[model samples]
Target chain A: MALISPSGRLRRTPFSDGVEAAGVKAYTVYNRMLLPTVFESVEADYHHLKKAVQIWDVSCERQVELRGPDATQLMQLLTPRPLAKMQVGQCYYVPIVDEAGGMLNDPVAVKLADDRWWISIADSDLLLWVKGVAYGRDLDVTIDEPDVSPLGVQGPLADDLMARVFGETVRDVRFFRFGRFDFQGRSLVVARSGYSKQGGFEIYLEGSDLGMPLWTALMEAGRDLDVRAGCPNLIERIEGGLLSYGNDMTRANTPFECGLDLLCKVGPEANCIGHSALQACAEEGPVQQIRAMEIAGDAVPGCDRLWPLFDDGRQVGHVSSAVWSPDYQTNVAVAMVRKDHWEPGTRLQVQTPVGKRGAVVREGFWA
Target chain B: MALISPSGRLRRTPFSDGVEAAGVKAYTVYNRMLLPTVFESVEADYHHLKKAVQIWDVSCERQVELRGPDATQLMQLLTPRPLAKMQVGQCYYVPIVDEAGGMLNDPVAVKLADDRWWISIADSDLLLWVKGVAYGRDLDVTIDEPDVSPLGVQGPLADDLMARVFGETVRDVRFFRFGRFDFQGRSLVVARSGYSKQGGFEIYLEGSDLGMPLWTALMEAGRDLDVRAGCPNLIERIEGGLLSYGNDMTRANTPFECGLDLLCKVGPEANCIGHSALQACAEEGPVQQIRAMEIAGDAVPGCDRLWPLFDDGRQVGHVSSAVWSPDYQTNVAVAMVRKDHWEPGTRLQVQTPVGKRGAVVREGFWA
Candidate 1:
């Protein structure tokens, strides 16, 4: 069900007809809105992930296309960060919050051009939210899923591996930077970004049937690199401090609490959805902020719900996330505590499902 | 959307509704057949994980309830392992394979009692498969989502943490063992098995309502123990060699080739869906077997895709899953390679998206 794209890369079952995720099974190609896909065994195709780099069919990650005259104006309403200053070919990590200041979703905003943009989302129906916001506003913008799939070339040697497929010049592409490349006579925008902290590149192929061919081409070109099949696992993401939506923060969490305040901008001149509440949250600091902590013992705690932080059995705040960090050799956790108890040196006690343990507050990032 | 369970635990919205998966925000609950609840923020809820022993609301990992006249017969047909002599209370890790001997899914089968079993599954639609296997057979089993949810107490100090909630008797339970305790006048079965290699316990609350009461009671009782919210992540799972369906082996991987032959039964008397195919595979031996390899570098590779395992520019196989083992301070990976190349010390090359890298097959656990 895969074919070569206009760019000569393999793509998903192409959109000569309409396509939709009918259900868990295979996707409906023509007239059907779903496809019954074989998800697990596909690992055989991912054999080139480790020592070598191969492309990923992350097309399942829903893409919200923003185009039209008011596209820029509409985007400004979604993200707390100002998109006015952003130019085409630029991207930024933006946190979209709800009315109560809770995080709606975290998406990567890619400014393809002045009047066109793409918001690659983690999870959450932001398209509906955007549409609702656009109901009364005469923003000349249209949102839809374009017939394109995002491809990632990741690994230790990702840069060199990709340069061979595209060109030697791709080796100089810095982190967070992107460039357009002509491969097989087709235009493709390659960006130096990925889920892993490891450096790599992401190529958005704008055509169907690009999966197998590109996969074959990468295999042929990368036949020398020892690559392995791999997929995103919940275990690695949490250990690496990568936040998952349904698993991490929900609509109840404000960007300020998730340490996303840097992306929130509420200058008097800027207008956007949920800006007032975000501004209020900014003016009035959060009651509790997300802080990382280190457990003193070898006993790594899993998901035990937060108990009031205690010192001499006195209550303070509660913890939110915790895990055994292989990098740190001790248990680490992210907790929401009152500003006073949020200090890095503050000592606290967490009530576990099993028993009590000693803990110290610290920063969130492990790497 | 969170509500109090009858047992006083804070039941997640879906659990409270007595459903395995809550309805998607886009759909009405009454009309939806399978409600796959999209949680708002699991990451934040997981914040308390590292510092304190946290209880996980893993209710999403549903237990396929099988209790019928021919339950034992059907259960045996589902797994590759021999379950003829399996006693009640014992659990077996079964690899469900298809006609080609590729894995369908791997689920933990716990024999609760005579003719009664529970299969805790990964994300898969297997109820129909089991039902089809039972058509016209004298099996009286029910397939439906239960109101129950599985809660886990994981971390280094899990034992001590459990003792606080269930009293010191918690120390008597062995690994993979379970015991019943009376709390809030409701009897609950607590097991010492957990996903983390680190020690911990899991308690299966019979109904959704028990979530909050148990969670609150444990939190209140273990106030001295730092109980935090935590969830599973990717980093440790790969290091521990835990295979995830969508990540490692898929329906395309046979038990023998996946290094899971130990879990398969290949006797003439045995009867399973893919038993014959598996037996022939055992006899002829697999052309490719999954093996662990130690890459010679500090650079952590991602699941970028399969790279070529080469010797002198000739291709052999590629690595499938790899990462920088922070604990071992080495790059490690799991790969499916030709049996000949799997030999220890076989030098190979990986085709990364970036460039070529050298690797030598090594032996033993990286962690």
Candidate 2:
């Protein structure tokens, strides 16, 4: 296997010091940034995450700050999701798409105000899309990448460890919501959200200078809670059905195909680029949809390529992400399956790098 | 150093099989694809490239194809370079910028026709930006990533190796010019270009199925010529003063700052996105500009992070790309330097990872 190269292009996060100290074993590039993929090991980290608290350098979830009067206008034009009811301090999971209703990015749009918002983006460069939209229409919006970096505190004891650092006021923060809290005299946005299904908080560390200080504080406060530096574990996320943008989806797949039709407010008034296309898609439904599956095998090789799903000789679907779940004791996988094959309990054959394996569609993701 | 996680998102090129079979040692993710950085070590590959023929799987140099009536109109709006004078067979190095004159990308605009073009891009996702502009203005252009992969035949023996496979007709391809040539009965776009000081041709293999066959044929035909699988060398690129997009320049830079003024036609008539700002910039001149430097030291650490440049007490500039050039016998570098510190022969101190080193500005890059 070829080793990945290093350069300024593969950006470093603010919490790199703590990550290195914890001995992160591996990484994967996200939005052209170094996102720590392992520490201890994938399986080891997964076990620890569910049982204890972990600090994650998810700074790669870089914020695309949209300010000015046209910010909301441009926001609505980017996604089918109705944003008129979104209040300040609320985070909404928005699936952004192009004119053809194809998925561009699945980002959490954080509304600071009517005139200001930040789209905490997934893998692809959605910023360029947003900027291009703003420029094309000559809209009155200032689009730029803010210095805001999200540091995640995930696991069962996340709230407990967070309370130690940010105070018990953090406990009041609801899921998918943010609140301003003082850290070292600096008010920062602390949101009750994260990549993992595990209960946690993602602290939006605004300034780069306070990065090390905050990381240190969290480490000291969570000493007894067994807080360790970790990242978005592959096994946990797959078991949770958290579809990765580049892996589970790309510009080729529509929001409907990703089972995100519930988020699409497809209408003439939707104002998104894919409004008309999605309106038609919503009526007819997607040809294939994202589904959870269980691959029958011991440990399968890492799913670096798409494993084609077959029902007899016909190609039924493809499994994009798969990892051996230590807790579930099965190879949990996510795939975009054809209509008939997508029904729960449907049997399919997955062609993994090693060989073919029996797979069954599951109604819901593993806990 | 940690291992990079393998995923379908870290795309595999058509030549990946050939690359692995030849033992590609390292890669750097470019445009979310695997770009080979080392084979028999960067130094060894550098030496071989200068002496013999080498094949480069630069499939990571993804193309952003523009087709339709508004293709030319959209192209002009994306860059400061004048596209009006560009001919069908010519390839112009275009500097794409946003409204504020910030550099978006530095791609080679391949003019296939008056209403068709392929922007052979650098590291960044220039496609999103291009698509945004077209969609924003509701232009009649269709922007899509074609299944075109560029395979480079480089080094001193490039023409010799190419002629053996492509016939004597390929030798007529002038620099920055392209001609369609039959490879296995399929007409492929063969451009007299590549990302190296060593002369070469970039064959734009349109369909991926033919990827291995072409690679195998190139290897088989050039066996006696000592042809080996190679990638763009860091040492050669730095010595040639080639500015890497994410490393040496980014959105924070302008065409003027990167010494790309020769390519910028900044004016109201330019019709580019950065017209007004670039016009003003042309008059005022850039605050800082890219410069070549010779760091006085042993091989500097892999320049993954920015090394601050100091002049006595005050900071002057930053060296982004640096390598120990075996041919140059010095640490060749590319830097964005402050105006006063940019002149040739200007001495400055560079703060490297190990320690500070004295660096002097060079009049020209070491060939």
Candidate 3:
């Protein structure tokens, strides 16, 4: 919730507990600036999540509402893909870019109604970006962050569990589609979208206090469903070839180089944000392209910054993100490499702070 | 990092981005006031974690260091347990308490060197508790959150990965024991303790810049070791019978009731914090006891507060936490039930928000 200050600048609404960035404690110690929270280790998480199911509080996914006559135009300007053919109840994975063709955010835009669109965004502040784009564009739209707490009910059994808890109506909602329903007298917009490639749902709530209540209600209802308290682990996310805005790619990356060229369409009569730059990139082709690789050994590839990749003692590219896949029992990584070496099965060496590691091109998705 | 204000008050060290809470983006969503980070969803983390090893950044786990001559005295005051029998390199999972025997913070106290104790605490600021207790008591000790980030390398292959990355020297370090060694010109304190029951290592770094370098080095050296990006998920942790402080126990809960009496001692020679309340509770026996339950449904049991248990329409106890264990394909839960109903195989009706949920008493270790 953003508070409109006396000066009219939007500021974060501080919580009564002074912004509990983590969470409330079961007990307070010393003066109470600390509490007890448990962290799950990686391996145990992998086994449980893949073989089973898990629940997570991913309320942080920002939903930018675009409703008005020019809502479609605003969306078309913000994203590289066209929203003209998108219909109500359908969701599209759209990439929001800047004029320089730089990536802004990768969001799942759902057409809730004829004119109302809910864009579930990644790390970037989509609301602010939309407001910025709305200015001077003459796009008639009402932008606001709904009081929605998107609870991620993820895992292989996500769909089944949702069917059980939210009623079988949930079973009818197709992929990339959303449905508004009543649970405990409160309205909810349940969408078939999530961070994990595993089948799941992101339930959007109207209030924060609703989190605990809904959390409890789901648990009680899911008692027979075998739902459990779980948070997203890093292993499966990276292994599935998923990209995090700040970790895998950032504002500095372009959609073309980030494996999003299919989204960029520069047609005449479309005055989208960064249209010229995207058109130029499309014509010239992306200098660096995103690719996946399999590194030899048990290395844990990290994304502090781009790490150099070498081929025949020559600089080729850098690894963007990497992780050891417990399933494949090998190291899989995503990197932006030179176009020539981007072919799958190409061999390369990556440099780390410790030493050089060998890598080979592999298909991106494990599933 | 704490910075001293001109007036002498302590302020958190600011980051270069002018963001006081640096890296907070990894946890909370700035836009969705109530949501978690966006990366949480797309990542079905724990799966890969199960098959391989994972390194996690949970620097959030605070540490309360006790280093004064009277530090041992402070320990006695905080815990109802006697630590005279505890040896260095060994750690104890103990609960700190208030005068009323109410829970404080549950910490894992590791004796690094003689009189030099490193107590890795849950989310609580136990250092202040220690400081306050020491102020008027005849004790000497220093308490503070160190400038260190606790990195966990956990998984089934954690041992092999550690040996390969940190060298065979790590093999000598037994579970719960820690040792200091030089790696790549930098000295580090490596401990074999991890949240997952599976084997793993924890390296406490003095700074964040080392994050990338250390992560890269580990990946490079452990290329043969399956390592993945993973964060802890709540489902497996609860199913494994791990006790979460905020969820399972709180300041209102006593060590006697939370099943920590085994770690408490009431000897007259040991003047620990909250000694009298613990002694009283011990003598009277705990009013409630923490136990595991097998819910009679496929619905996942969740922490919906204390669901009152009723036997023959008579109030008995309450269930605190529950989950659907995909591994077991049943609902499992942990609760603080009345002593009378704590017996294994006892049948009871758990009054959930939805309705009366059936439950049966089970052993503590559900996993």
Candidate 4:
């Protein structure tokens, strides 16, 4: 790996000072911002996150705020998910797609009111798409990026640490829900949702000036809980079957191929830009689908590119993400396989960087 | 600087193998692809780029291809510049803006034909914006990214090296005009335009399979000319006043504010998306404009963030790009200055990360 050149173009988040002080070792550029990839080490950080707690500066999950009378209409046009039933203080995982039913971004839409919403995006610049749509159609909505950064608290002890800082009332927040909580006279939207299978809360810090203060307060409050600065661990996410945008999928794949059909409400109630195309896809079914696999090998190298899966000397699928799970003592992988080869216990050969390895399809992911 | 984590998400280009073989020292992510920032050293590469021919893997300058009946109409809608006079083989430097006259990207529009064009973009995902517009307006256009990658050959010896590879007719190619040239029996669009003051040509390689062969051919053909692998140098770009998008300008800036008023044709002949908004800005001149400046200091630190410029105790502007020029023996900078303080020879103080330094507005760039 080579060093990343320093420039204002690769933006720095507000929590960079604390992150640097905590000895972040490696980083990845997400949404043109520096996202920490390692702290102590990949394996050490994975073990620490599972046993204790960690504070993640996920400010790279930028928010695209939509406001005004036509905000709801514009939001519905961007995704196939049904947003009419969504109430205030709810967050829905919406798969944004283009006109041909291709995936654009998989974002979490936070409904603040009838006329205001925030789409917390993945790696791509979803803002340009939304703004272009609104302008081209002459929709009555104001769309822009807001000054909001999400700080994640994850682990088994996440609730305990969050309760101590935000109060015991935080424990009552339901999954995929948020509530306004006051800290230092600033009200913030605290949601009980994160990118990990572990229990956690994501506090949406609205002001840049409050980033360091809140980070320090959390550190001081969780001193006894063995808290540390951490990021989304590769080993844990792969084992849990968490899909990463721009890796597992891109504009070439439809939502149905990614096993996101449940979220695509293509009926009359949900009229979206890709509704007709997705409805046809939902009926015809996808040619390939996502599946969890277990590879029989010592340990695979870092999956920097796609690894081809072969069945009887014929390419049948490809593995997008793979890692050795120390807790499970097996090589866990996420693959997009052909429909015929996606059944459980189907044996195949995965061509890793080192060499070919035997792989078997698993029914479910290891938590 | 920390190491950049390798992943399939941060895309590698077709020329990556050659770039790695040349021992690229650092990289920057542009348009979600790896762009080499250094090979030997910044200063070393800067001097070499001025004297001898160097092959640059500028594949990160992705193309957003627009082809269909509505392609010309769609192109006219995206920028304020008049495309009416543009011939089929010409390339125009277009400053794209949103409805409110904010710069979305500054790319070169390559007119392939009457119904086909390629917007060779900067760092941002300009594809999404184009797709969104076409989809929302129901335009008959097929928008997609083609398998095109540009390899730049730059320096004082560029003509000699290119003539040796493609015959003496290559030396007669006019600036900003592209012609089809055969390389390994494959036709490529070779334009006499590049991102520096030195003379060069950018060959738009249409196929990825020919990337390595072409790269090797160039290297082998120019061995006696001190040919090396290089990239856009920081000091040379600053001295030449080549403003970088996302660093020197963003969506917050309009074309007028970037001193591009001459290109923003808002008369009756042109009807662009930002025409009305830009006309208003033209009637009432910009509050601030881009200017060249000279910092009074030995050398400045790597400009990783905005440096504030103060007049007495009031904030006047900010310097976005700055570097110490080895040839000019002074610190060259590009700054956005307030109208009241943009006059040449106006002295001010710039608050860099290292310390405060005296600065003066320059009449023009060094190159």
Candidate 5:
């Protein structure tokens, strides 16, 4: 691994000072911002994240703000998911697709009001797409990236730590729901959602000026809770089957193929840009689908590139993410396998960087 | 500096193998791709780049291919620059703008044909914007990122080294003009241009399979010319006044503010998306404009964030990029200054991370 060169292009987040002070070891650039990949170590971070509370500077999950009378219409046009039932202060895991029913981005659409919304995006530049569509159609809406950064508190003790800062009322926040809370006289949107399966809260910090102050406040309050600077651990996320957008799926795959069919409300009634194409895909099942697999091996090398999956000399699928799980005592992986070869207990061969390894399709993720 | 975690999301270039084999020391993610930032020390690489020829794996300069009947129309809608006089083989340094006449990206538009073009982009995701426009307006065109990786040969001995590999015709290629050259039975777009004041030719290698082969071929052919693996040197670029997209200008800036007013032909008949808005900006000159500044300092730290510029406690502007030039024996910087403070030789105080430093606006860059 090479050192990441510091530049203005690869942006620094608001929580960079605290992340550095905590001695972040490795980083990955997400949405053109610094995302900490390791603190003590990958395995150490994973263990700590599962056991105690951790603060994640997920400011890289940039928000694309849409504000106007046609905001709801524009939001509906971008995804196949039904937004009519969504109330204010709710976040929907929307699978944004292009006209070909291909995945452009998988973002969380946070509904602020009928005329305002924030699409917290993954890796791709979905802002350009939204702006282009709105401009081309001459829609009565505005699209741009606002100065909103999300600071996450994850793990089993997340609730206790968050309640200490935002009050015990935070405990009542339902899943995928958010509430306006006051911190240091500034109102913030605190949501009961995060990237991990572990219980957590994501505070949508509105201004850059309050970034460090809030970070320090959390650290000071959670001193007895064993709080540490952490990031989304690869081992834990893969085990939880949390799919990474560019890594696990790209524009070539539809939502159905990525096991995101539940999020795609495709039908004649749906007016998404990829509605008709997704309807066609829904009729005929996906050719390849994302599946959890366990590879028979020791610790594998970094899964920097795709590992081809084969069954008896025929390529059937590819493993997108793989990591050694200490708790599960197995090498867990997420693969996109062909329909013919994707079944529980089906044996396959994964071509890892070191050598070939035996792999078996699991019924589900470890966690 | 933190180590960059390797992952498929941070895409590896076709020449990644060659770069790794050459002992790449550091990288900066550009357009979600691994861009080698240092092979040796920054100063060592800078000194070497000024003398001998070097092969640069600038594959991060991704191409957004626009094909079909409405390609020209779609292209015209993205930039304020006049494209009427552009020839088939010509490359134009066009500054792309949004509806409000703000600079989106400054890319080199390659005219392959009337209906076929490639906008070799800078740091941002310009593809989404182009696709959105085409889709919204129902234009008969396609937009996609093609597998065209550019391998640059730069420095004083560039022409000598390139001639040995691609024949003498490469020497005849005029500045900002390209010619179809054959390499290993594959036709490539070889243009006499690069991201440097040093002379060079950028070969638009169309296929990824030929990346390593061509890389080795250049290294083998230029053995006597002291060819090395190199990247866009920070010092050299800043000294040459080569503006970086995200660094020197962003969506908040207009082309006129970046001293690119000559490129903006915002007349009534321009027929561009931002023509009218830019005409208004042209009428009322920019409030703040980019300028070259010389800072009085021993050595400036890595400028990862914007440093605010002050004039006797009143905020005047901000410096975006600053570096201590070993050759020039001064701290060279690129700053955006307000109209009242942008005049040459105007003194200002730059708030660097270390402390306050006196700075003066230069008439031009060092080189």
Candidate 6:
């Protein structure tokens, strides 16, 4: 692959200076901002991330703020996740769909109060859609992308590293919840949730000027914890069955197909934009869905495009992501398979860039 | 400075195979697609482009399709530019805005018929916004992104190179006007407008299968014209004063501030979503507007962020894009200057990453 060049359009994160000083090796563009991908090497970084604490510049997880008297009302109309019962400081993974039940973005809705919330988005400009709907319907709400950036601390030593900076109160924050913690005399929202299956916290850093200071503090404080700059590991994420929005699924997919049925509230009074279509889909069920597959081969190459899966030369599905798992001793892949062919132990052929490879559906992702 | 690793999320263009085969060295993601930034080198490509024809795989310019009984109505609601009189074969540069006179996207709206049109968009997801507005308004319009990718044949020898495969009728396609030209038994929309001062034609290649075939034919036929794979050059565009959506202007800007006053027809009949706020902005006039500035220095570094401009140590505005014009022998730049400092010959200090430099407002961009 070619090296990526710099442009003002592909924005820099708040921790860009720290990331540069740490010597980020590779990056992937998300939400028009830089997200570091590789530090030392993919395999080496993955191993270190599991053993020690690392700070992640996930600033690309842009926040779309909903503020005003009608904020909750507008929020409910955008997703089927039943935000009415969501408590303040609770983070709920919401599936934002269109009128036809197609996913627009799978973001975590951070409920701040009754009339103010933030949607920490994966990718795609969900704000434009929100603004358009708000304007078209004349909703009493303001929609915009705030300057807040999320810096993550992940791994087994995450709590230890965080405690060194924010004190022992940081460890008390429960999973899927956020609390206002004092740092440099200002309160910052620190959520005990991150993208990795490895335990961590994502601090909603508000001020850009404090980005470097906080990063430096974390690095200095965790000097004994083997702290390093890291990003979401592909090998670890696939093992944990973390579905990427544009890759693992797209607008053609519904929440049910992406194994996000737990997030949907399709009962009466759901009042979401895709309520009707999603309700029908939930009842009828998706004909095809995401599954974990194990390929019988050496390490597979990067999944740049969907690799077609065939049952006796007839296309049945496609593999969206794949990587060699050093721990698993096999190639783990994520694929969307047809109804009959999705059962565990079902054999299939994946036409990859290297060549055809034997694959079998797994019961579920590795723990 | 990091290399960009590929994933299924960052999409590949129809001509990606050909681009890679031609030794593409660098890329910059736009609209989640790999856009070739350099083939040999930026300077080498620019020098070659000014003298010979080059093929550009600008598939990142995704198209948002509007089809239904209320398509034209929905189109008019999206942009302040009057579209009632747009001819079927014409392409108009429309400024898509929200209700607050904010620039969402500056795309070329291609009128296919009275009830069908294609919006060739920039970086942001304008489809989601349009869909949200349509569904909210209950307009009888269906919106979606079609698989139409635009390939450019640019430079001085563009006409000669295009005539070999597309025939002499391609020469008759007036500026901003598109016509159906037969290619491999398929009629492709070829428009005589591209993103450069050097004239070119943009072929809206529809099918993914035909991407490489057309690319091969163009390369073979234009061998005498020294045709090579190329991309939008940063230096050439900065010199031409062509505004890049996310770089030079963002949602924070207005069309009038972008010097696109001629495109806005904000009279009472104009039913654009931003009509009222735009009318207000037009009446009040923009406080800061985009201007061409000449920096007194050699080539400046890649503008990864906005460099603040100052007059006697007081911040006045910022330069969004800047580059050394090899032909002009000076640094040409695009900046948003305050009303007071926007006049030609007005001097300012640009706080660049390398160092501070003397700058002066230019009468206009070099032709």
Please identify model 2 stretches exceeding 4 Å from their true place: none
Judge the docking of candidate 4 as incorrect, acceptable, medium or high: medium
lDDT of 2: 0.91
- Alpha carbon lDDT at A191, candidate 2: 94
The superposed Cα distance between candidate 1 and the true structure at residue A62, in angstroms, equals 16
For model 1, residues B1-367, the per-residue Cα lDDT tens digits are 1111011011233233322222112111100112121222322322344345755556645677788676887788778898888877677778886545767668777788777888776544354345434532424665444555677787776778788778899889877767787777788777788666666887878865677777666666666777654445334555667665534565567988888878888879867867889999989988887777777755644453456677778777777667665556766777677877888888888776557777777674444
User: How well is each residue in A256-349 modelled by candidate 6, as lDDT tens digits?
Assistant: 9998998888978788999999999999999999999999899989999999999999999999999999999999999999998999999999
Model 2 vs. true fold: TM: 0.99
The true-versus-predicted C-alpha distance at residue A110 of model 4, in Å, is 0.4
Predicted complex 6: CAPRI docking category: high
* DockQ value for model 2: 0.78
TM-score to true structure, per model? 0.48, 0.99, 0.48, 0.98, 0.99, 0.99
Clashing pairs in 5: none
Between candidates 5 and 6, name the one with more favorable DockQ.
6
Q: What is the DockQ of candidate 1?
A: 0.01
C-alpha lDDT score of every prediction, in listed order: 0.61, 0.91, 0.65, 0.93, 0.93, 0.93
Model 2, range B150-205, lDDT digits (tens) per residue? 99999989999999999998999999999999999999999999989899999999
Local accuracy of candidate 4 as per-residue lDDT tens digits, B53-147 = 89999998999999999999999999999899999999999999998999999999999999999999998889999998898888999999899
Model 5, stretches more than 4 Å misplaced? Answer: none
Candidate 3 structure quality by residue, lDDT tens digits, A253-325? 7888888888777857556777888888888888778787777876563444567899989998887666677
Best by DockQ: 6
| Stretches > 4 Å off in candidate 6 | none
DockQ for candidate 4, please give it.
0.79
Q: lDDT winner between 2 and 4, please give it.
A: 4
Candidate 4 or 1, higher DockQ: 4
Candidate 2, position B273, lDDT = 90
The reply for model 3, stretches above 4 Å from the true place, is A1-39, A301-303, B1-367
DockQ of each: 0.01, 0.78, 0.01, 0.79, 0.86, 0.88
